[model samples]
Target chain A: MSLFIVNILDGLVTGLLLFMLCSGLTLIFSMMGVLNFAHASFYMLGAYFGYQISTYVGFWPGLILAPIIVGFIGAAVERYGLRRVHKFGHVPELIFTFGLALLIEEVVQYFWGKSQMAFEAPGVLKFAAFSIAGNAFPAYKVFMIFIAMGVFLVLLYILTKTRIGMIIQAALSYPETVQNLGHNVPMIFMGVFGVGTAMAAIAGVIAGPVLGTFPGMAVLLGSIVFVTIVIGGLGSLWGALVASLLIGWLQTFAAAYNLRMADLLVAIGLTEPVDVAQSMLSDLWTLTLPQVGPILPYLLMIIVLVIRPNGLLGKRET
Target chain B: MNRFTKSLLGAAFAGAAMVGSFSIAHAEGTIKIAFIDPLSGPFASTGNQGLSHYKFAAEELVNSKGGVLDGQKFEIVAFDNKISAKESLIQLKVAIDQGIRFIAQGNSSGVANAITDAVKKHNRRNPDQQVIFLNYSAVDPALTNDKCNFWHFRFDANADIKMDALTDVMAANEDIKKVYLIGQDYSFGKAVAAAAVKFLKAKRPDVEIVGNELHPIGKVKDFTPYARKIIASGADAMITGNWGSDMVGLGKAVIEAGFDNPIYTYYAASDGITKTFGEAGEGKLKLVMEGQLNPPVSDRAAAYTAKFEKQYPDYDIGQPRIANVIEMLAKAINKAGTATDMAKVAYALEGMEHDSIWGTKVVMRASDHQAIQDVHILAHTAKDVTFDFDNSGYGLRAESTVKMASADSATTCKMKRP
Candidate 1:
């Protein structure tokens, strides 16, 4: 039971972390009507920048400054780069972001080299916050959970209770209508894009120490973040949150168990096991839960896509 | 156009052609060894360091010793394989087309396996055109076992040999009770885990293997959960064959989790890992390697390391066998009395024995073409160490040395000689 509780806590931490990235991506996708392929790359930039800043000014200063820097870079990208490409339609914008992602990775490699950087958590947060079932929960992980939750609540309040959030939502459904009221739709779009990337960067700053700051860090989380937002629904922030948490829990639960397909096969009335070398089902027979843990998210995504194409909280088909 | 001017132009063109051919001939006269490994991508740092060492060995060791085989100087020509087996084959073909006879690669055992098969097929099909493969670092045991080829020879001890030595130390340590085995989900990782289990069972039957897990190679973003799982299992020690970013990530995660249990690894020291590990790994992390830098073995080895460090400050000779590879290859060529006749050189290399810089006697076992030498288990120490690695201000101090058996004992290789 304690192990189960620990797994849940661990899952919540992972799920909340995913929500941080998915929320920003979903917000950007909803407002722009174009999926930002470079969203994870922005997160990577955040981690790298945070690492660099932390070296000089410590982690706290990096936590505040890295996201601000990333926000400016994102705004510049939207204003200077994406605005010009917008006339060509969504595909071009998507392609531009994709190219931007690759370029960012190359730039990172050029500057940092292709090795893992020593981006460590702050000394105070390095110890275990508590122990359950003989397993000490890292204080840094608990810190991640709290920070992600705090971001979620703050973001929820701003989006629902504030006037800027109302205008953003209004622009999402009817951009021209919002623009007719002299609300400066383009500036709002830039702001949303900037805010979205900044959120991802914030996640990066906190997550980099744990996930590792490397050139491939973006690629590792890129598709999974997309899957989270897609499974939650393309434009639904709630959907992104639900999907991210579900994946986090699912993967954690799977890894924590050691279930085997061979045992299942034997329980299903196969008294004799097939020869592993000669049988075609050898791989299936040898499959274990931990071995297939990473792919469980994709399996869930496939199920969701097949059964409900729009996602759980998604309004339209994605 | 004047007739005299036309004649003058023709003579100049003829003179240039003669000069080009003479230069080409002179270049071809020198022995060429193609260094094929990843020069780009994630593994570039390792491959580049390997290349630098090969270059240094060729220059400082072989060429500086008045060349090998009657003044036929050795040269290293580099080709980036991009750490892909397909790319390595393509580069191998390109190297062959350019009249290169010797190939040196030591990054991935998968790539090494591919090259060996391709070289074997190429030699069988085109007997007149053959290339000898000198493997310096890839340690998948199958290369010298089931996949052994006459065209291929490994200077580094295979995985089984290294694991045998590692488990010997593990068995002797009474403090170790429960152990966990973790590795990258690949051939090399699988080999390490299998060998660890087998040897530990035989050497120390009382040792409990609490957990054995394999994670996706190079894809895992975080290893904290894995470290937590290891901690939960109450393992006293962990053994891993993960290298590169995997090693770094796992080590950092383990350290952060405050898992004080020792980690025994195949590659937890070199590259940027030692520096990144810093004080976290001191006294806790241990590595099994062919050479030790801390005690410097001999005056000659110390002097060589100093010279190499002075020349290339960025690289440490991670694969110390690089020196052995060049020195032994030179000895073989000289003994065979020809640099061009690879068949005679291969014959000369078979069953050859020498005293290596590590101050150990190394034997190139004739049966499997695998080098047999004493392997050392080094402990990561911050102080009371002779030399530090990667400018980390921490070095691996030799804790135990295991004298290796002949290749025949460890290998199931039924080598078919040409």
Candidate 2:
């Protein structure tokens, strides 16, 4: 069915966008054992910056400039804010980031106010790239998919195949040894942190037009990013990729299918209730898959946490 | 759960502090009115705009016209309820504690229901300390029907009334063969959907109901999947009761996905939705509401529009009902001969007839406290519109008007007068 294909495309777009955020978050967690709670806020910053710059400069220039500006902000945050709190252990770092998240939201509201911004994709991407079953899949989404893939490949190369990547990973476990080798570990940590946040901003710049650039944009994607990386295995990049795609397809298929729990219960030998609205189990009887689509990722995270606490591809035993 | 509850409590404290600051510099003898609505969160823009309207109307209409009760200034105070029913009750207690005698809130029907119930009980418990609720935008018919309260006076036409007008216009359009209904999964959303189903069936029996869907309120990040479903459903037109961010998201997504059919909406033309819809849905969006904006109904309407644009350039008078609320409230207060006489003021408001800011007659029906007024169905288009929304060069062009007689719905209200 063309509907089926469209769902796949839709799912892929959602999954890849999630990956864009997840990859940065996983990278930062692996490089420095810090769970950046304010990662999504950087994405929100990216959107606002993009909107502002595009209003003056244009989308093409904003795309390149927004992330760079956000990277500098992220670097400053790591240098001035996170580094001071780093000595107090992980909980304090998390507390700092959490506070930072709230602060970013308030600052954004102060500046842009609490309404959806009119940040649109450029005119070039407005036309349909293709159509399936009378649905014109726009060019912007395809651009998003490719940009996400490019980010994945480039990040993989930088982390695995390059000299800076080698030093960054080496410093994670043996910071003293890496630092003694005439390299600054603190600066490296800040760089990784900046890069991670910059990647999040990149996601923001692209997805802002589609998902809407609003004050609540960061909060909307906050919990879901945690779910994706958790299900993927905390420090595993490939696991994050697999998990993001899985969630994408799972949610897409779940939304597409109008399967009812009552049908499932009946199929499993339970009798259906008459006068369903008045039945004690009316909620269960009428519950549909699509209604619970948003919760599937969290449910999956719980299952993974219970079945394999370390995650699907995580190397650590804990 | 502990963290969640702590954050909620923290927010409540902060809200109380904000309300505390607003209570100072009251100006003695000023008739204080509490505007309890969300000053923050997802629906903040809508609520904030409502607050601005109340403030402006109180100043420009009531207070500036030499004040009510002969030079007793009208003051509007802000209370952040966060759009939660429980929070709204919390704010109501705070408002009542501050000696505020009137409450204006209309953003959420669920919150409105909670406020009405609390006000009813509060009046019964302390009749001497009664506060009249001036409902401006909450339009659930149940508020005026089964849950009707004597202290509550709704200036906006209820949902059923709007649907009566919407379906009346929709039924006349032959191109609409299949209808898809989508709304937020909440009381207001459900009310709009139910009203649409009832009216559509009654008016256009031949129209096939293709899809009736409900998505969670303010939770959906992407509406592309929903748009894909609508595209697959082959619906000729989609009806949504979503407001605020939901309206913006749904409108943008459907247009992006090339679902070029018409979208019939309740609150799609203001509160930043108009500009977004203008960018995406130029000719595809239609809205039904009270008051006129594009072609100002009269000279006074035109002057008020110009003044509003000057006062709050960022805000449009999204709820013309808010102006009606202030206008009628001031009239009732003046007629009652005392601002503190809640009973007399409520009585005066009953069956009151007044012209709205848009130069239309609004009648506050005695039985239900629901305003019966002319409802206009406006198309969000760039054609033949002088006053554009959000300065987007696309504004509402009135397509059809439903008079009060045809738009009126018979209520099941059994008035329990005090």
Model 1 has an lDDT value of 0.87
Share of reference contacts found in each model: 0.39, 0.53
List ranges where model 1 is wrong by over 4 Å. Answer: A272-277, B1-29, B125-129, B385-387, B405-410
The sequence of per-residue lDDT tens digits that candidate 2 reaches over residues B67-109 is: 9987898899899999999999999999999999999998878
Model 2 iRMS: 6.7
Chain A TM-scores in order? 0.97, 0.98
lDDT of 1 by residue, B73-145 (tens): 9989899999999999999999999989899999999899999999999988887788899999888888988
Q: Best candidate, DockQ-wise?
A: 2
Candidate 1 lDDT over A1-318, as tens digits, reads 777787788788889988999999999899888899999999999998898888888999999999999999999999999989999999999999999999999878776778777777898887779888677788999999989999999999999999999999999999999999999999999998998999999999998888788888899999999889879999998998999999988887887777887888889987535577567777788788878888888988899999889998899756
The 10 consecutive residues of candidate 1 chain B with the worst lDDT sum are B1-10
Evaluated on CA atoms against the true complex, candidate 2 attains a DockQ of: 0.38
Tell me the TM-score of each prediction against the true structure: 0.93, 0.93
Which predicted model would earn the best lDDT?
Answer: 2
